[model samples]
Target chain A: MHTDLVAALDIGGTKIAGALVDGHGRILLRAQRATPAQEDGDTVMRAVEDVLGELTVSPLWSGARAVGIGSAGPVDASAGTVSPVNVPGWRGYPLVEGVRRATGGLPVELIGDGVAITAAEHWQGAARGHDNALCMVVSTGVGGGLVLNGQLHPGPTGNAGHIGHISVDLDGDACPCGSRGCVERIASGPNIARRALDAGWRPGPDGDTTAAAVGEAARAGDPVAVASFERAAQALAAGIAATATLVEIDIAVIGGGVAKAGEVLFAPLRRALADYATLSFVQRLTVAPALMGTDAGLVGAAAAALTRRNSATAAGV
Target chain B: MHTDLVAALDIGGTKIAGALVDGHGRILLRAQRATPAQEDGDTVMRAVEDVLGELTVSPLWSGARAVGIGSAGPVDASAGTVSPVNVPGWRGYPLVEGVRRATGGLPVELIGDGVAITAAEHWQGAARGHDNALCMVVSTGVGGGLVLNGQLHPGPTGNAGHIGHISVDLDGDACPCGSRGCVERIASGPNIARRALDAGWRPGPDGDTTAAAVGEAARAGDPVAVASFERAAQALAAGIAATATLVEIDIAVIGGGVAKAGEVLFAPLRRALADYATLSFVQRLTVAPALMGTDAGLVGAAAAALTRRNSATAAGV
Candidate 1:
C-alpha cells in the first residue's frame, strides 16, 4: 500500500520533535530530542539533525514528499532563517537550508510556531470550518497567527500573527520587545502571576508563584488574584478585538498555559471582548479554548507541509 | 473607439459621486448629487439613483459593464448591504442590489470606502508596488483598508482594516463605537483639535479650532499644538505598528484631512512608529502620505470593479 507523507519538525527552546504525518493528519512515526538551546548554533542544528536522522532511518520515510518546520520565532520564511529569542545561538540561522540538506534536498516549508499552531487548529481543531480566525497561544508569552479568507496568513516573514508584541497600552509599561505595554507583557502566565504578586496576592502554603497558583487563588475568590486575571483578560480581549477589527476574524482560539485558567479567564475575556469588539461586524467574535493540545506543533507543521504540497501540485510544480 | 468601462459610485454623508471609469482608471465621465442624508432610506436611494441616472444617460454608457460602489461603512459585501454610521437613513440598505437594478442589471461590487481608497492607492498611488500594505484615512474619523499578498482584503463583510476602532489605550477614553481608547477616538481630526484645545491652545483670531488650525499652530512651534499632534501620532503609530505586526505590512499610506497636517503629523508619526514597531520584521515599516487625493474613492471603486471583472472573466462567469 502506498501512502503520501510529509516530514514535520517542531523546533522550540525545549525540544526538537519530528514526525511522518499522513494526509489525514495521523502521525505514522515520530522522533524527538531535547534541544540544547543554550549551546552553540551548531549544537542546536545537531539536535534537529538527530531528529531528522531518526525519521530518515524509518522505512515509512520513503513515502515522505517534503519537509515542514514550525520553529519558535521570529522566523523569516522569506529568507528561510530563524532567530528565536529563547535560542540565542540561532540568530538569523539558515534553518530551512540546514533542514533541506539534512532531509536529502526535499522541498521545505517553514512557518513560525504560532502560525503552525494556527494551521493545525484551522485544519483540525477549534477553528475548523471557520474561514477567518485568530489562533493564539497565551503561555509564557502570548503569540498568535491569523487565518484570513480561509488560508493561513503567514505574511512575508512567516511571523504575521505575532500579536503579543502589539501594544495595547501605549502609555503603560515598557515591554522587553521595546514596545510599550504589549499584550504578552500584560497577559502571559509570568505577567499574570507577577501582577498578582505585585497586587498583594500571596500564593497558597505550597508557595507556588506560577500563574496556575494564581488561577487557583482566583477560583477561590481572592480579590487580587481575580483582579490580576481580569486585567490579563482585558489585555487579551483588547489584542483579540484589535485583531478582529483589523482583519475581520470571527473567532479567536486561545491555548497555552494561561488559558488553563478556564472560566476564570474566559468569563472576563468574553465580557471585555464585548466592550472592545463592539463593531457590528466584530460584535459576534467568539473565543474558544484551543483543542489541538500538545501535539499541535507537530500536527501544524504537517498541515503546513500538506498545504504547500497541495498548492505546489495545483501550480503543477 | 469603444472601450470597456465600469461605473463607480462614491457614497458618503454629504454627496453621492459617480463616474464612468475606463479600464485604465481614467474618469471618462462623472455625475454627482447632494445626499439627502437626513431623509428616509428611499430618499437617499433616490439621490444615488439620480447620480446613476446622469451616468446612464451618457452616450458612453454602453461601454459600462458593471458597477462598483465605495460607500461609507460598515458595508456588508457578503449581504450586499450597508449600515454606515453617518448615513443614518440607510441601515442595512440593499446597496449592491439597488445599484444593480439602477444600472439596469449590471453586476455590482460593494466595498467600504476605506477599502476603495486602499485599492486606489495600491493601483496608482503610494502603495502601488507594495505587496502588503495598510491605507488609512485619518480625517473626521479614522478608517482604513488593507492589501495583503498584493490583493485587496475586504474580508467577508467588506469592513476589514477598520483600524480606527481598534483600541491602543485600553483603559482610556470611551469611543462612540463602545470601545475604549480606540485609535480614532484619540487620533481623528476632531479629536486632535479637541485634545489641543483641552490642553489650552487657543485658536488664532480666525477662531478656527480645526485639526488644520492645530497643525498651523504646531508648525509655528506652539507647544500645546505640537503635543496634541504628537499624541495623535503616537496613537496612529501604535495602530499602524499593530497592523504591521498582525499582518506583516511593509508600509502604511495615510490619507485624508489630518494627513494634510503634513510634517506636523508625519514627522512625529515616523518617530512614534519607531518606538512601537520594534520587532525585526516590522522595524522597517514606512509611513507615507497618500497620493490618490480626493478622487481616491472613485478611482479605488473603479479599481475594485476592474479587479472583480477580471476575476469573473478568469472564472468564466
Candidate 2:
C-alpha cells in the first residue's frame, strides 16, 4: 500500500470489511473478519482491533496514515459515534475513538454505514462523476444516502436519508419509528419474505424467502409474489418521486442484496413514478444499480477521510 | 438607500410590484400597479416600462446601481428572459434587456418567480435560519423555491423548486408544464375554485373559483367546500411527505394567496403528511406560512440581488 494511504473499516452486525485506499481512489490492501457483534461494545471493538492488526502486519500495506470507519445507525458524524438499531449492545458507542485506538491514535472519522456505502458508490462505483443522486441499499433493511445539489445531506442528527421510514399508508402497519405504513414495513427484504410466507408459498426456509426468490416466483406467475414486489415497487416509486420533486436528482442508484431482483424491483417503480410525476420538463429519469459491491463501505470510509484531509489542508493546519 | 441599491421589479400576470432595496437587505422604496395582462407582449412591456419608470423617478429610488426582475413561468435565469404562462403574450420576451433599456443601462438579473420567493423567504421571512426548506406559493398558479443545506438550488435550468409540476397521480389532471396529473391541476387556487364550482358550490364571483373561497366555505360548514380543500390538502400533504424523504427539509413555509386560509388548509395538510410520509427521519417535519404576504416578490428580488452582490464581492469584483 502507499505510505500515505488512508485506512477504512466497515463495521456491521455480522462482519467487518476493511481496506487501504490510495489518493487515486483505488483499494491497494484489504482484510475481512467476523464481527463479535453479539458481545458487548468493547468486545466488538476488540474484534475490529484484531483485524486492523492483521492488515498492518501484511506485506501488502507498507504504511497507513489515518483511519475512517463506517458504523451502523443513528450516527452523530460530528461527534463520531453510533448506536445502531440492529446492533443491540452498541448504544452511544464512541466508534471514532475505538477505531482511533485500534489504529494507534491515527485520526479517524465515523459516518453511518449506509451513508458510507453511498459515498463509496459516488467515489468510484455506479454514481461516480454524478453530483446529484440518491443511493439506496435494499438488503436486510431499507436505508439510503443522498448527494444533493453536489453536497451530502446528513441531517441535524446525521440520518437524513432514512428512506425506509417514510410512511406510505396512514392506516397501515405500525413501524418502530413511531409511525404507521412506512416503506420498510411494506417493502423491505424481510417484509417481502413475510408477505410471501403469509400467502402460503412456503419458500422452504425463512432465509430462502429473499427478494430474489419473490422475483423468481413472480416471474413464474405466482400472484402472491407478483403482488409483493409490486407493492414494494410502488412504495419505492412514491418515495423516489417525492424526493426527485424536492431535490431534482439526476439519477438514483440502488444497491444491496435485495436489488439483485433487478427489473422486478425497478419496472413497476418507473411506471408508478410516471403516474405521480406531472412535470414534463424532464420526461424521464435514470434509476439503476450501484457500481460498488460489498466493498462499498470501506471505500466510502476512505473517501470520508480524504474529504476531512482536504478540509484540514484548506484550513492550513 | 444604500449607494449601490438595485431596483427590483416583480411582474405577475395580475399585478406589478417593484421596490428599490438597499444592499443591506432593506426595501428603501416600494410601489404596485394593476397589470393589463390580457394585452399582447409589447403592450404588457409598456406597463412594465411605466412601473419601472416610476421607481427611477421617485425621490427615494433615483440613484439605483443595478436592476432585478422576477416573473412567473418557464424562465431562463441564465438568459434573463421568460415565457410566462399567465401573462398572455410573453413568449421569449427580452425581459432583462427591456428592463435594462427601461432603466437606462442598469444591469439586471432575472429568475423564476419561485426562486425569487425562496430567496426572499430564506433571507428574512418565514424560513429564516433554516438550512433546508421549501417556500411554496399556491395561488393563481403554483410556484416554489428550495433552500438546501444553506444554499439555493436553481438546477441546470434554474427551476429547482417547481413543486406544482410534481405528479402525485398519473390518473389526475393535465398541467401546462406539458404533463398530466400535475399537482397544480389538482391543488392550485384555480383548480380548487373550478372544482368547487363544478361540484355545485357557488362562491361569490372573485374572477375565479379559488382556495380562499373554499376555505371560507369550509369555515362556514359547507361540506362541498370542506371536501375540496381537503382534497387539495391531501395532495399537498402527499407531495410534502415525498419531499421530506429526499431533502430532509425541516420546514415548509406556505405562502401565496391560497395559503392564507390558515388552519383550514394547514390542519388537513398536516394530517395527510403524517399519513403519507415513509421515513422516521423525514416525518419529523413542520409547516408554516409566509410572513411577507403579497410583498414577498419584491423582497425576494432584492434578496436575490443582494446575494449576487455578495457573490460578486467574494469573486473579487
- Chain A TM per prediction: 0.99, 0.91
Expressed as tens digits, the lDDT of each residue in A224-274 for candidate 2 is: 888888878877765565556556666778988778887777787778666
Residue-wise lDDT of candidate 2 within B1-317, one digit each (tens)? Answer: 35778889887878988888877667777777788788898898888888887788888666687777778766766566777877768877788888888888876777778988888888888899998888899987778888877877666545678877665554355667655556677788888888888898986667545567778988898988888888888777766765665566889899887888888889888887776664445556899999876667887787777667667878898
What interface RMSD does every candidate have? 0.4, 4.0
Each prediction's DockQ?
A: 0.93, 0.32
Model 1 RMSD vs true structure: 0.8
For candidate 1, the TM-score is 0.99
Model 2 chain A: worst 10 consecutive residues (lDDT sum): A276-285
State the C-alpha lDDT per candidate: 0.95, 0.75
Docking class of 1: high
Number of clashing residue pairs, candidate 1: 0
Candidate 1 chain A least-lDDT 10 residues: A1-10
Off by over 4 Å in 2: A1-4, A52-66, A100-107, A167-176, A185-187, A190-208, A217-231, B30-50, B53-67, B76-83, B88-108, B140-142, B164-210, B213-238, B264-284
TM-score per candidate, in order? 0.99, 0.83
lDDT per residue, candidate 1, B236-317, as tens digits? 9999999999999999999999999899999999999999999999998999999997889999999999899999998999
